[model samples]
Target: MICKVAILLVVASVVLASPYNPYYQQQPYAFKYGVQDSYSGQNFGRKEISDGNVVKGTYSVDLPDGRQQTVDYQADKYSGFQAKVSYTGQYH
Candidate 1:
């Protein structure tokens, strides 16, 4: 009886686990390609599209408190990526 209850509890825990959502934890100023057939957010630019791939562009995001952060994605992967964060004091 104890073993059966434990098995049922394990099954119920697995069923109540969080659903898998890829976009739920994505970076605010980061862009990735090839996840889907086309880009899904404003993080990418049309001009950056070249030869069926992303070449160069700037990705910007506004924080909850009106702060802006921008990052530039170059090449294919995360290589040569630069991020710029703006605050009332200065840009970093």
Candidate 2:
């Protein structure tokens, strides 16, 4: 009987400590950055934010062909990352 009681208690604790538990949560964050140097022709930046369950961001880079490449992305716990890539400026 003691063995049965112990097993039941363990099972109850496991269920209580699952993802549904109030303490089982992730923190949210956000950030942005950039870089530009005319001397070296280096230019790139990124901005991102996460609300624990999903993440969203945008990043851009200076391309060698005189165009800028930008990417907007989103990702969720289950759906994986999705992005839209675009370019701007004249091509040489």
Candidate 3:
């Protein structure tokens, strides 16, 4: 009986906490280097911000073939010079 009750409580808690879980919903924020609302030139870089903190940034690399390589990032203080990329699929 007690075991079943505990299991039920655990399941309830898990369901309730799922929404707040980082895996599901992340807080909306800007980049660290400060991204412009729009980019005009070929080469561009920008920052990411989350909860008023500089989270990460994105930079555009001008390739010799005229194709631009865009990079996105997420914060990782423990990993030296390491960050996660957050790419946007559509502009609209």
Per-residue lDDT tens digits for candidate 1, residues 11-40, read 989877857555565332433442222343
- Per-residue CA lDDT of model 2 for 1-92, tens digit only, reads 99999999999999977766576787899999999999999999999999999999999999999999999999987899999999999999
| Higher-scoring candidate on lDDT, 1 or 2 | 2
Show how many residue pairs clash in every candidate, following the order shown.
0, 0, 9
Could you report the Cα RMSD, in angstroms, for every candidate shown? Answer: 12.5, 4.5, 12.6
Off by over 4 Å in 1: 1-47, 51-54, 76-92
Comparison by TM-score, 2 against 3, better one: 2
TM-score of each: 0.29, 0.73, 0.33
Candidate rank order under TM-score: 2, 3, 1
Model 2 misplacement above 4 A: 1-24
- Clashing residue pairs in candidate 2 (N, C-alpha, C atoms within 3 angstroms): none
Q: Which ten residues in a row have the lowest lDDT in candidate 1?
A: 43-52
Reference-based lDDT, each prediction: 0.48, 0.95, 0.56
Choose the strongest candidate by lDDT.
Answer: 2
* Better-scoring candidate (lDDT), 2 or 3: 2
Ranking by lDDT: 2, 3, 1
Clashing pairs in 1: none
